[model samples]
Target: MKRLARALFASVFLSVMLAALLSLAPVLSKHGSGSLPVFRVEQPMHLTEGTLVDFLSRQSMNMRLHHVEWERNSLTLDLSTTRLTNERYREMYLLIQRTLTQTDNVESVRLTVYDASPATPAPLMTVRATRGDLRKSPAVQQESERSYQQYLERFFEVKRY
Candidate 1:
């Protein structure tokens, strides 16, 4: 009876340990082997236009400008962040579009994601959608996601230190 109980306990312990490790695999794998810090987005939808400028200011210390303006009838949200990864950039971009487009009199939205890193040469990604485009938002998002995957496939490398 004692041996059976010990075996059961060991199996349960091993299973729990394996589960814990599996859960951490995604988080560990995403952050480049734990060498670099990761910024976890906490409730990105709560970000307001007022907070948008200030939040980005603190988030992108080296960024020269974070601006939002009216262009024609559409609202343009332009922000440059050196610290945010391409994946995070897409997320925040989509989040901002959803948040702003749903509020008040926004007819169309344009989000420009800029890589403001001094090391990086000039390159920017833009996503534009009108109220009509909301129906196709999922398709737009999928294209962006596919682009990110292709980017990772081309550039992602595993390094051991």
Candidate 2:
């Protein structure tokens, strides 16, 4: 009889612990930098969320667009990526810039990238470009790849968190 009572007590204790942990999940998730919750808001422009998602996914199988914060004339895109390379970021930026419409409400684009593989997550890097700067930067068709890359290197700032 005593053995059975002890077994029941142990199970009950474990159940209570599990319930407490489950309740704290949301609190923990909110504090974590690695995993982010996507907010659902009305998209600002015709540029479309699906287009950006598709473009980024096509660029790398490991990267994903976590969220987008749309402003009147600028867009802040949060991307979770395991692939970390300057060339890769530039290539993706070029692809993204090419897709933006000149007449749209979005004049500037900022990519706030987080390290997907980090255990204690912080922002990995940020890449931003304005439409006017894009026009003044090296032309894709007319200029050599080196010139375009140099332009990207000069204008696109990278800061590690």
Candidate 3:
């Protein structure tokens, strides 16, 4: 009788452990690799708009994509980046504009940035420019993001930084 009871308890324990492991398999498959999984059926793009959004959102935990509107060759991005200093806002804006303008599908880009840290949804800034404008700067379309932001304020600014 005692041996039968011990065997039954061992079987139940093994069954529960197996059940728990099976339950976690799907989640572990998605996240256990320390990076997000890719399950796309489309052709691979190292940096398309989706990846761009991911990169921007990951820059700071507070920054997020609020909305998006796509026209024929123009793209509009609405971002909620909690109260940012002038430098930070410029950094994000240029990063977004420069990379997006390089893509084939995007001829122009518009960004409407909102400050989400305030109690009343404070300041908002909107800038819209085309690939031609982005490329016609002092760098002649050949500057790193840091250097590019320096001299193209006219082409890229809607108001203050």
lDDT agreement with native, every candidate: 0.54, 0.65, 0.62
lDDT at residue 97 of model 1 (Cα atoms): 47
User: How well does candidate 1 score on lDDT at residue 48?
Assistant: 52
- Choose 1 or 2, whichever is better by lDDT: 2
Model 1 agreement with the true structure over 83-120: per-residue lDDT tens digits: 55656544544444454453445566665656777675
lDDT of 2 by residue, 36-95 (tens): 557745343454554555544544433576787766656777777776665655555664
- Per-residue error for 27 in candidate 3, Å, reads 37
Q: What are the RMSD figures for all models against the true structure?
A: 14.3, 17.7, 11.9
In order of appearance, the predictions have TM-scores of 0.39, 0.53, 0.49
The collision pairs in model 3 are: none
- Highest TM-score scorer: 2
Off by over 4 Å in 3: 1-62, 119-123, 140-152
Q: Output candidate 3 Cα RMSD.
A: 11.9
- Summing lDDT over every window of 10 consecutive residues in candidate 1, give the lowest-scoring window: 152-161
Give the winner by lDDT.
Answer: 2
